[model samples]
Each structure stands twice: as structure tokens, then as C-alpha cells.
Target: MRTDMPAEIWLDPYRWEALQEILEQDGTDIEEVLQNYLIEVYSDRVPIERQKEVDRRIKKERLAAVQEAEARKVFCAMHIREHGQEYILMEKNGREFLQVAVFLRRYLRNEFTTPPQRVRPGI
Candidate 1:
């Protein structure tokens, strides 16, 4: 991961202070500490209902990502049928569209042989 801090941390004094405190803790995992601190502090900013909605959206997005990855693998397999392996391996345009197409093709074929596992929200 990149070492750069987000602009929000620089803009918020309290957040910066909390970050500094996390950094100052000796022999501890700084990243884990900072993550927990940020989650505890920032999650309070939103209403409970809004947070639930956000959590739901995040879960949906993660599910979509997993589906997309699976579709990409299947799409590559199909593309390899006509265009050869290089077509899937080579850098090319329309990759995102291709993934979607592959997903649709699989759906139409009723070939959901191995569906991606759903991830729990707010992990």
C-alpha cells in the first residue's frame, strides 16, 4: 500500500492528533491501530440508519467485484476459444465490457457452476 496519508487527515486536526497518538504507540502494529482508531472515530459521524445503508451498499459492491473477477476468468476461457490465449493475456481495450459480456454469457448459459461467496458488510 502507498505510504501517503489522505487529505482528510491533514484537514482534520483531531484526526491528525489521533493518528499521531497511534503512531507514538511503541512496538504495536501502527496500521492496525490507525485503522481501528479511524473506524471508531469516523463511524460515529453518520447516523445509524445511514451507516446501515452504507454498509449494505459496500456489501453489494464487494459481491459485484467478486462476480466480476469470476466472470473475467470465465470470459478469458471463452475468448481463448476463438482468439487464442494471447488475446486474453495481451493488454487491450474494452476489458471491462468483455468481463460484463462474459458474465452475461455465463448467465444465459445457466452455468453458475461456481458462484463467488458473498462477503459480509463492514469488515
Candidate 2:
């Protein structure tokens, strides 16, 4: 496969041009068609593997953003007791504040918790 050759040719440039011209003529209902064409053209250039990676990256970034937002929300919730009152749990804290909460919860648990689990499993 020659790299110089067009990866994919637009099959209906005339139709595309006609659509554009019609839109210009009537000035309505062209956004959907243009979006479809744009998506088609975009998909053509982006290889399947690259597209997958791009999608994966996009999803990963979205997830990370959500997670960070959630962490902030949780941190804020844990911090503020009322309109003006700041909770001691979140105010006097460092990065290990959440960890402290976890350890405290574990210590307070009454049920038979699992015995100290191995940090590293046998290989």
C-alpha cells in the first residue's frame, strides 16, 4: 500500500457539493448531513487501532476527570458540616486524611474482619 495514495477517497463530492449548495440556497436542515459527512471523513483518516487508542484515551481522561471531580466533591462534603462550619475531619488534613478515615473505620468495625491480609501474594 503506497502511503502517498489517498487513504480513502470521498465517494460523493458532487452530492456533498450539491448538499452544501442546497443549504446555501434554502438555509435550513444541513447541519445533520454536514455532521455525518464530517464524521465519515474523520473516520477515514483515523486508523482503527489509532481510533481505538484515541477512544480509550478519551474515555480514560473522562473517567479520570470524573474521579477527580468526585474526590473533590467528597472532600468538600467531608469538610463542610453546615453553611459556615468546617468539619475537623477534612480541615486539619493532608493527603492521608482519607486513609485516616479508612483506618478509623476498620478499627471501629465490630464484625469479624479478615485477618491481616498478605501485602504480596506468593508468586
Candidate 3:
């Protein structure tokens, strides 16, 4: 997992201290406030196509995560003849497991070329 680093600023100490005092009075974290401000600005100035691209990337990443988690839970056929434990088994030996793994793998591959698009209102 990637740790999010706080945004770096080049403000002088005087103004920085003033901002900190204001934030202390408001009981808000600077990072949260900055994030909200950035989001607001993004919504205001970013083009719809660019926003859609970002949305697609986020959706694709989320889909990939769900697929990977589900893959870890892929069903393995055990107790079958010649197939004792499916710990390292693949393909027909694992039946449905192969299809799911392959399907997810292909889906992610396609995502690399063409991420799934998001539907938006008034578009």
C-alpha cells in the first residue's frame, strides 16, 4: 500500500504560523482542508473529458482490486482423482478457477488499453 505524503508548500514561517492558528481555531486538519479545496477547484476548472478519464482510471483500479481479491477466493477443486490438494493446481484440474482467473486477467489487460467509461448526467 502506498502512503500518502502531505502536500509540500513554500510559504514563509509567518504566514504558515498564521494558517496553523486559523486551522487550530477551526479544529480542522490542513490536509483535509487542502484536499477539499483541491477537489472544489478540480470540479470547477477541469474539463469534463479529463474528469471522465480520471473517473475511468479510478473505476478500473477499483475493479482490478475487487477482481484480485475475488481471485484469491477462487474455488479450487479438491478431492478429485489425481488432484489431491489444489494449492498449486491450475486449468482443468481447478475447473471454474481457471475461467475466472483468465477472465479477470483478460479484463485487466483490456483495462490497460481501454478503461471502462463512467456515465454522467447531462453528458
Instruction: Identify the candidate with maximal TM-score.
Output: 3
For model 2, how does the per-residue alpha-carbon lDDT over 1-73 read when each residue is reduced to its tens digit? 1122233436487887787788878765466556668789879998999999977887888888889876765
Model 3: lDDT of residue 37: 95
Local accuracy of candidate 1 as per-residue lDDT tens digits, 1-123: 123355332337687667667777764554566678888976888788989997788788888888987667632222222322121222223457667677656645757776423333432
Per-model clash counts, in order, read 0, 0, 0
Ranking by lDDT: 3, 1, 2
Task: List the pairs of residues colliding in candidate 1.
Answer: none
**1 against 3, candidate with superior lDDT:** 3
Native-referenced Cα lDDT, model 1:
0.57
Of the candidates numbered 1 and 3, which has the greater TM-score value?
A: 3
Distance (Å) between predicted and true CA of 17, model 1?
A: 15
Shift of residue 60 alpha carbon in model 2, Å? 0.7
Q: What lDDT is reached at residue 103 by model 1?
A: 65
TM-score of each: 0.39, 0.37, 0.48
Worst 10 residues of 1 by lDDT: 83-92
